[model samples]
Target: MNKYLELALLFAFVLAETVGMWRIFSKCGRKGWLAAIPMLRRYQMGLCAGRDAEGRQLALLESGVAVGIFSCIFFKTGSVSYMVAAFLLLLLIIPYTIFSIRVYFGLCDAFGRNRFWVVPWVLCDWLCALIWGFGSDFKTAEGYPFDDEDAAPEVSGIEADLTAPGLSINITRRTAMSLFKRKVLLRDIHLIIPMGHMVLLLGGSGSGKTTFLNAVTGYEKANAVITLGDSNVYKEYNSMKYDIGFVPQQDLVRGSDTVYRTLSDAASLRLPADMKSDKRRERINEVLDTFGLTPVKSSLVDKLSGGQRKRLSIAMEYISDPTLFILDEPDSGLDGVMARALFEKLRVIANSGKIVIVITHTPDRVADLFDDVVVIAKDAKRTGRLAYYGSVYDARIFFGKKSMEEILMSVNRREEGGEGRADEFVRKYSALAAGGEV
Candidate 1:
């Protein structure tokens, strides 16, 4: 109860926790010194428990909170009120507690402890760390679930048909940095889509759908070969850029510009630099008619309806008359009838021999329009892997689901309220790609 005794107890607790964390880090194959650092210690602990994502976030929150506390102390003599500092600290602590609890639970899992261990880890973390760190019985479990060494399947799938006249993507792996560590976004995605087929790019949240598209379009080059109609996309992005039409979810047209002017401006940017004005105008008119914007050519973009605005956006991209067309949620914010009509237009483009790939949340609404489907799923390590790539009917049979939405559910994680068969499907598809039966 004495102030000196309280100080002594606090110092001892800190020393015990630090020593325990250091030992835990060493056991987890990390440097023991990491436990001594303020923010880095929290992050390293997250990694030890296989919750790297939450760990990185927790480190950031901890850093922010420390900075806020320091500022409050430094400015105590200034106009800064204690009540404001208290409220600010409370706001940060709520989320901080949530993230810390998750990391603690992950630590419990890593050390082969039950959820009940989280209670002591939260209330008396120093003691828990000492017990788990130095106890003879406490050791990291073998075959940890979050181990990523064998995360990717060895199945390379079918070889890309470079001679085939369509979009061919053979991404070995797409990686990016996360908290100073390399993280894989996608891996072992190899498939060749033939010309004139409308392919649906299906994946749940964080499944790398957009990243795959960016790789295909050469916007973000991955470590793989991508061929589009006999041209290497990464090697010949300058020329291939014109041949790939990408309609993003949001329209970028100006409100003051009329539909005709919008297309004309797009034509100037998308069309060949050497093209004559007359020829460019002719091509713009064709695109205007193709997307059904001819009637509203003189209408201001702001005055256009949702469907009309969406069409204009497509027309702007279509002004290039690309051989490979890709749309990210082209029907977003449109009603059922409008979405169906939009997909019908895409079908027409495919009918004209252009490769069409689309990503839509409501794929079942226009399932009949797509010729093939490319399903991507995140494996246990959270890296996107190819789950299925074939006809729509075949996808139904492969996933054993009746609809596209159901197929998505089948590959989603169990926590997402669906079958957690992503790794299963990835292996099956790999075997199928190697000329073996699933």
Candidate 2:
């Protein structure tokens, strides 16, 4: 073959590879310009493959190869030291090459591609990139099963003798205008909200956090399945509604009425008529005591502090001895100290054997106050979708951020140009849930 022909073919392949990578980066919710850079392209490729470890490994390989080539050039001087350095570099290169191959295979698995595609990725790499960029869907890889045998046992002294068993909620959402075209906001959301955990529902504006809470409370319509102990929410909602309570963000107490009177009125409205007046009064006092409003029980609702007002709202919902509580932005319009105090109150409420779900927009300082979290993000089509749902500690690790605020910032930064990868997160979680691995 002619040398010029070989050179021309090399140029063509390089161009194809560049174009392929550009498309792939764009598809993976990253900036396409990253593919045009030299070392950045490899890093971007690793990110597209759905794991930072892959990108780091690729970068290490490139560094190792560069060092080895430099050592080889120096060895031509016939220096013993250069030869030793080259030998060591060669040793490093061998393991790096093997690891790089493993990373490549892992990338293939993550992208749902054939393992043998590594061949084209290594030889005619442009063809592999083209196939992956165009044909493969950018989604996260399946997670491995959690080994409970190696897990630590719970030692908390507070045990729940649950009167209301934990609830499992599932919802599939669609718009009224497009009934035939179902754009799922929440998909197969299976959460076992136990009796003694404060769950924080998190998402950006328009991420459907409010909608989810409303659906769980049976205020919003959807294809939903909610189970409480042996009862189906759909079939037994009239009876089950007594077991649940919802506290809206806005204060609901009558400003002119005293705290005690407000709760008394609420109890009268919600409690059964068969209950004696003394029993209703006893229940109101108990709720006021539970929320730590006994001292301010005689104060007018308008005169209560902001935190006290919030607690009053919660206390109103507790009139019927509800076993499950859902609060929307309980910390809104409060200072940091009051917010923390409110969260502490919620923690105590959860510890009392009630399944508590709190929704808040400003939770950075109070992220640690919740026992668990349900995180959602907006997809490419601007539909709300679940991003992560698990323990707060695990969520930090999953998002690679130290705090929920940082995680939200990272997500926002990723979606700055409207290339949100929330759909990918949902797809991955769905696959994991179906396989019973998450």
- Estimate TM-scores for all models: 0.80, 0.58
lDDT of 2 by residue, 1-438 (tens): 554575577567767777888887776568988877755676677666654555666666666666665565545446887788788788887766665566567667766667886776776677877766676564434551111122111111112222346877655553433311344554434556776889988877777788787777776666766776667766777777777899998998789999998998889877988999888888888888878899999999999988889889988887887778889998889999888987888888788988889888787888887888887766554556666777899878877778877666544424354234455555655544446443
Give the distance in Å from residue 262's predicted Cα in candidate 1 to where it truly belongs.
Answer: 1.0
| Candidate 1: stretches off by over 4 Å | 1-15, 22-40, 48-50, 57-128, 131-158
lDDT of 2 at 246: 91
| Model 2: colliding residue pairs | none
Q: Can you write out model 1's per-residue Cα lDDT over 204-224, one digit (the tens) per residue?
A: 988999999998999998998
Superposed by TM-score, candidate 2 places the C-alpha of residue 57 at a distance from the truth, in angstroms, of: 52
Instruction: Give residue 211's error in model 1 in angstroms.
Output: 0.7
lDDT of 1: 0.88
